[model samples]
Target: MPDGTELIVTRSPPVNSNGVITLTNRHLPQLKWQESLLIARPVNQFRDFFPEVNNQNLTEIAIEIKETYNDYLKSARSLEDLKNRHPELREPYIEVTSAKSQRTIYLTRLDRFGTLESVFFSQDKQFPVDLQLVNNKIDREIPNSLLAVATLDLEGKSVEQPIGAIALSSVEEYNLKAGINM
Candidate 1:
């Protein structure tokens, strides 16, 4: 905001733990150390709160991001189609992103009514350097529909599970339904 670019800072869009970033509408809590905002729009990607840009670094980053997104989309589509034909797969799944070495994987499974599960993890040697095992297993159902993000700490090979979920009803059903006039 030092550049004097006014940010609406609305509460509807819901920010993530990384704080209110415009592009990632993850409605997680704002931790004390996170600067990522709780609101986002398409332009949030270009909002550089770091420092002045000199070369085409920003452009390059954006290009790589697009490529990554496309790769994920293609993979997800393929997985969905496979799941459709083989309905007995039970819980069909897809791993969204992975590092070059296959040491890390981001996973999501396809569900009925266009719903999908969420998964996230960060890897580091310092993350419980002695951690020999991780039991990343989840299987639960909420009778009342609600939105929730599960948080886990890979450090020390333990996790602090999420307590509750936010409400499902919202003003914005369709993307861009929240008028720009606001």
Candidate 2:
């Protein structure tokens, strides 16, 4: 782990096996890119990064983002409809800025094989984080695990490294744990 990076641990359910589970630990950097875009934390948590912006204004900016995304989804009946209703949605990425601070965040959406790829955001022209999901093959004795790697690029190219893994729980097991009946 690098300086100012925190480790996040998550559990992954076993696949086609008995009661075995895999746990993954990921390194999360405390950079503005991560704080402002990657994780789903409170807006106030990153206020220091934007000293000029107040908490209330930051909260409003967050709400506006959500509402815009919701509006995009609701009006996305067709490609033409999306382009006509919200011209911004037609672009591969969207850029938003804070009114008071003038701090900007760029959001990029990628898709492959009819499935949504990673949606990355950054506070600069170049993306700072590149994440990938990798499946790890294991023997019959051990539980299966999936690895999530985050490649951080700061200072243009001085520091870049892969850090992180994620585990998903089985639906049946999760339901049982939550006391939900099917």
Residue 98 lDDT in candidate 2: 32
| lDDT, candidates in the order shown | 0.38, 0.40
Candidate 2 residue lDDT tens string, 21-116? 312122234324534533335657776886775589867987899788767756654666645544434436433343544433322222211113
Model 1 worst lDDT window (10 residues): 173-182
Task: Pick the lDDT winner.
Answer: 2
Count clashing pairs, candidate 2.
Answer: 0
- Stretches > 4 Å off in candidate 1: 1-54, 92-182
Clashes of each: 8, 0
How do all models score by TM-score?
0.23, 0.19
**Residue 68, candidate 1: alpha-carbon lDDT:** 86
Model 2 clash pairs?
none
Backbone clash pairs for candidate 1 read: 15-38, 18-36, 19-36, 19-37, 20-36, 20-37, 20-38, 22-40
Report lDDT (Cα) of residue 50, candidate 2. Answer: 69
